[model samples]
Target: MSQPQADEGIQTSIDELGLPLSETTFVVLDLETTGTSATDARITEIGAVRVRGGETVDEFTTLVNPGIAIPATVTLLTGITQSMVATAPPVEEVLPDLLEYLRRDPGTALVAHNASFDTGFLKAACERHGHPWPAPPVVDTLRLARAVLGRGETRNHKLGTLAAFFGTPVTPNHRALDDARATVDVLHGLVERLGPMGVHSLEELRSVTKPPTKQQIAKRHLAEGVPEAPGVYVFTDANGADLYVGKSKNLRHRVRTYFTAAENRQRIREMARVVEGVTPIVCATELEASVRELRLIAERKPPYNRRSRHPERVHWVKLTTEAFPRLSVVRSVKDDGAPYLGPYTGLKEADRAREALLAAFPLRQCTHTFDPPRRTVEPCVLAQLGRCGAPCDGTESRADYTAHADAAREAMTGDPAAVVDLHTARIRKMSAQLRYEEAAALRDRLAAFLRGAGRSQRLTALAVLPQVIATRPGALGWETGVVRHGRLAASAVLRPGTDPAAFLASLEATAEHVEPGPGPVPRATAAEGELVLDWLTDPATRLVRIEGEWTCPLRSAEAHAEMTHWAHGRAPAQ
Candidate 1:
């Protein structure tokens, strides 16, 4: 089915009634969907190739928010995520914009693969978003595929296999807009071979988008042939440069629709300018297509691809058992295994918590703020109120002061055993001194040990392990997934591969500890681990790698509770 590029698909009728060689405008539209049923699924990406006569022109591509979280598989297939789309101007915002662009001529025809899916997505998106649905003149090469290639030409009429059989040059397959553009190439080839239709006028081509006659509908299905059986396809330029990529169940029909639409002027124009080829890959199922598309996009980072552009980067507060410790903030997790705070949004948020520690705990204000005596008099206001365990005045013994500093450091940094050790030490000292009141306080804090250690459930899992975390790769966002037992989970989101040992180390001060030989057998997924081992074991090694992600996970009760709290307004820091 092909519709006019506008509500009307009247191409310019010229001298001798010839198609506009460079003026017969057409839009090649493509849709990225949730599933096979265009009626039930939402569109994630929309691209179209514009063409005039036989010359390609321009292109239009956009990632839609879909008003829902993209499935992990879908994200993998299209590289379209909930966040990439979060700020994406909505479809309603773009549809009108597209309409205005197409209305430039007011009579161009619209084309798409299986035109129904893209058109369906368009219709639904318009209706759902409070926009009017207009019928535009359209064209479908799916009809051409059947008529030109005939019913018994191939076992299946897949866009790729068909292109391959017909000798169309396409490679690096399957992306929404890319495939739509490629289908145009196929359509042109077919039309060239088959000659003009019975109704050769632009009006005749425009009639394709309207409700087809029963005979036409039957013929349309036959032309659609065996649905491509769900797969991914890629659209490329004449030089094989990727312009767009896409996926669908029936590649033949889906690819065919784009060649027939008229509203696809922008896309058609873009494709005409850059595209000269296509590539398609059939998947075992729709799910496979979605998954493969995402991975391919993520890896390739195509010119038109979006998402993971700026991976999540966070500022962290470091808490260490090292000397002169209080609370220090940095931009990333540190190395040296001292256990630091976060990859948070900013220093201000971390500062809020730092203030709480200074007010509530009797910890040293500064390591050397009083060194050499800056005031020459009092220990400033901190010592006056006993808030400072007194590094400011030089009155407190180093032994006693540093001990309290260590304990405070423990609390601020969220060290689990640190709580246990502090509690035990305080209890022992109080017992010797007969200070039962202080000892009891330590006991209560110990009971809340698990509460503090829990840290509001970073767990992304159900009653399971944490999963679905985000990380940064240099300046890009990446997501890593894990499987605990048989259940899938996303775990430990980080940035830039988590290989910056110095960066992670900066988050915390390390206590100079001597290791007892080469530690136990290592079984951790750490970039540091990979780098260090490679450096030491084989100095010649030039390669090292890391990973990260962010998403809802199947985690333990503790983590699930935390994420739930965060998603709502009940977060701990809040």
Candidate 2:
């Protein structure tokens, strides 16, 4: 694909838009059903004609035994009586043939007068008969007529009206094949009308029916060079500053929607108007595209792309590096050797985890530092209420405070049984005292702690591994990834019949060397690690090699599962 020059200024040639309408295959179809409601209706007749460049290539027509009597009203309207379908094949026997006809040519668009009605009945038939529905791109002639024709040019946007207006040789008479043949002519007429309005390609034709805004129509050229493959896309301003970052499996189709009325978000529409150019970076697979998208959003911090920009802003519950250590919610994890509990997405959840730790241990909540161990003459409210041992006031000895800090560290890193027991006991006591709200609040705090602890343990299990190589079968080949310390170091797609062992060795040799850092995710953000972990845990994934054990503690997993059940109002497993 040729890249557009910077000075072109959005003047798109009709040839660069997409597949031309003249070269596109259209399967114009019509269906006669027993009723209008898809759920309650049965298709009695299916008729479709394949047309290309204003010429018919093939035709398909079939009568289906609905197995249900056709209503008298439906019989009068469609002339498909019960007797006519009694000798015909059932829908199950006819659907496979129709599906095969539809898939005969790839990129064939399904055209109908009111597409929803016909497509709805067909989809319902597929569902009822346990057949897979081939979800095809649809073009409704009625919608096209409404968009292209003026009110004075047509009486109504119905099939018969369109047939009369277009001077079609075949007149629609509510019979499937005849209506289908008439619709083919009507479709050609609408396409002819759209030609003069810059709707030359299939993509433009689809968008033109939406009657896109002026900004959208003007900026449609930005999507011209994007290839239909999985990858990331960056939208930039004229000055080359990043405006937005996104990813899609089909880069061209997804990018084109932004220049059409289908993109309904106001912010996105405004972003589309200011977009000066689009940069497409094609990837080997969808997973690679997702990981790259996350990394780009974090690195660029584009104004239009929300989420993942402030990955470092995540909160962590840490044991503060002070003489009298206490649980504190910090925004970052450093290599200070202090135990960390989480990489929580929200400060509120981190605070809840901290509160849960404080409930179990009498750790100081104050932000004061005591390097020289200065003692206060007056104790704070927490100390007076016996919630704290008044370490600042010298009521608590250094040895006693050390013990509390040790237990807190253990709860954060190792076993959390002490904290769980303390909180559960408090909840039971509060419930017995008829303080339902306080009990509920305590339960929430405990749940939050469990969630953070569980996530931290799961991530640490993967982050501690020096290297892990895994693969899964892809459409064209095998998709493989090299991970180091829970970060995606490298990824590749090996063509089918390629030797897996050799490919794995080559990928590992050139993969990124990740130096171990601190916290749950040693070399990557928590979100990125989670994405990698999801890929690793998929049942289809085959573990080729591992440098270290990849497992979470049984107790931690159980606690997380128990908390999940309790949070959802279900009884915890025995």
Candidate 3:
């Protein structure tokens, strides 16, 4: 590798360099593949120009028999007919010859117009032949041209366009040799434009524009169809292995949103390139979609998807069993013997609830601890305060403690509205009778009910637990995207209709199924919480109705049943 330098001898080799350039050499290559994708397409042509020490020392260009009929679209693009490459040297025969010519002396880096596309084809071809190219840095002249000439000067950076701009002409046709020559001229002009010392070396040129990679095309994108179907969808490769899973109500529309509206091109491109196919499953309802989504995430555990390893790490409270049972907070849900109340966020909060119930109205902390044989340690603080309706005193009956324990547990989970009404009535009676403590207890109970009521939501019956729910309102219907973590695993599209065929279609289309779970409860007060409640309870809530694609839920009994199973778990086996 050599370049013309100051005080250099007047020689043909250095003179042929076309400029006083750097020692770095470049291998410019081109290919005609059977298709746009490297993996699915075969290469039919190979062309290259090797420049060492700024001199075009060698050239390699040939048509390779790709062993397959070149698609017409590619033929039109490259003009290498299926017949032209049919009898040419096979890739195995020519690749060796091509490599030897290009890699003989000081190794030169690869160069191409749209490097990502060419590299993809070459990589796929080489990998298929079991002879991968060595990892070499790339020098993209397209980028060099763009930088040397402002973007405003040219709309497209093709060789002929640049050649015309610089007035360095080529006489041969659009063959590999001619294109490579034209490209070299473009490179020379760029170096001159940048100035000899301007771009110190070819290495500096490579530094400017890195080669391309697989890019998601803009063809499949549909800008307006986001918030698509509320069912589940699974993305897969050609091998049918699940790459990712998701649920959406508007099936067709939501898939398009990723390709169209998603802001992250890198992520979308990865998803699009890897997603060779899609699997869609319509759920009975949105709730079922949620359940299905979780099931898919947990089951598939696709590479990109993640979530909390232990659900209870978030916190909760549980009620354990005993004659004088304790109401305590548990950090994790375990296979403990008694029915549990929650898995709550803070022990301090749990303690506050405990004190509220005990000081004003004392109850036992533990049933087992107060047992006759002294179950464990000495009875705790409850026994000291007369707070314990204790079995330790041998006076507390199992039935009496059991009733009080059940009442407290019910106060936590049972319908707070019903409890609120009861407490309100009792408080009024106490107030009227002038019994302050009684009225005060009833007032506290009523307040607790009101707070709990804020957490409740009445979703349509097709809902379930152990799932995440997302909603998208469409012209035809509500589209729900059910997901767990970030990957889509399953979905359901429930339309309002009586058509049994459509109903069954919706059920069968479900991506993956999950056990239904309750809707998320409000953890804090905000307009968002109020908004969700209003949307749920609003009688006028409506979805845009699409014709044959989806029907309204109002007209379909099958959708109703599907929605119920989705919201609630499937009926207990028999």
lDDT of 3 by residue, 229-274 (tens): 4678777777988877766656765564344222133554566777
Lowest lDDT block of 10, candidate 1: 565-574
lDDT agreement with native, every candidate: 0.48, 0.81, 0.51
Error of 2 at 51 (Å): 29
Q: Per-residue lDDT for 118-149 in model 2, tens only?
A: 98888887764435687676788888888889
TM-score of each: 0.33, 0.62, 0.34
| Winner by lDDT between candidate 3 and candidate 1 | 3
The top-ranked prediction according to TM-score is 2
By TM-score, the better pick of 1 and 2 is 2
Full candidate order by lDDT, most accurate first: 2, 3, 1
In model 2, which runs have C-alpha deviations exceeding 4 angstroms?
A: 1-211, 371-377, 425-436, 567-574
The Cα error of candidate 3 at residue 17, in Å, is: 45
